[model samples]
Target: MQNNPKIVLLNGYGPISINNELLELYPVTTSHGAIGFPLKSLRAENVTIVTNLINFWSLTKKMKPENMCYLYAYGGLEDEDMEKIKATSIKST
Candidate 1:
């Protein structure tokens, strides 16, 4: 939990948003973990995580309800971004 990415809310998406400005200041790596698809874009008020990390999804589901957060399958990072992350990690799977 100490290293998890903090979740924040936006009243709505707007350019020059304070939240976007703030997020840009910090470093985000895939090591922080995939959250999910954009919920607001999906029109869901709660967090929904659309993750392909099946084992992780099942494990978390047993521990907690599927709140609005998404574990999006191949979410967030683009192909180039994913490549960069893979470059940094040791081959575990």
Candidate 2:
């Protein structure tokens, strides 16, 4: 295990896909909240991911568990702020 397992908690909706290039380098998963998303794999390096939140409420139940984090925006933050959230640090996530 990593000294500090990092989980990229990105909140959006719908089915999410990581780039093929990225998936090759890191383990990824699609899940709800920060509990069961892929966290250990993210510690390998710094990565930014895009996810869809279109129907998250209904979809989350169907999602399998992984070790990742989930950052929620919910239209409360501006675009730039979201970018900063993604770029700044793992601590923020």
Candidate 1 lDDT tens digits, 1-93: 342332222221112113223221111212243222222222222333333356444543243332223324333434433332211111221
Q: Model 2, 1-93: lDDT tens per residue?
A: 533323334432322333211332113223323322333222212322334444333334554443333343343334444433322224322
- In candidate 1, stretches whose alpha carbon ends up further than 4 angstroms from where it belongs are 1-40, 48-52, 59-69, 78-93
Q: Judged by lDDT, which candidate is best?
A: 2
Write down the worst ten-residue block by lDDT for model 1. Answer: 8-17
Q: Please, what is the TM-score per model?
A: 0.23, 0.27
**Error of model 1, residue 89, in angstroms:** 30
- TM-score result, candidate 2: 0.27
Cα deviation at 75, candidate 1, in Å, is 5.2
Top candidate on TM-score is 2
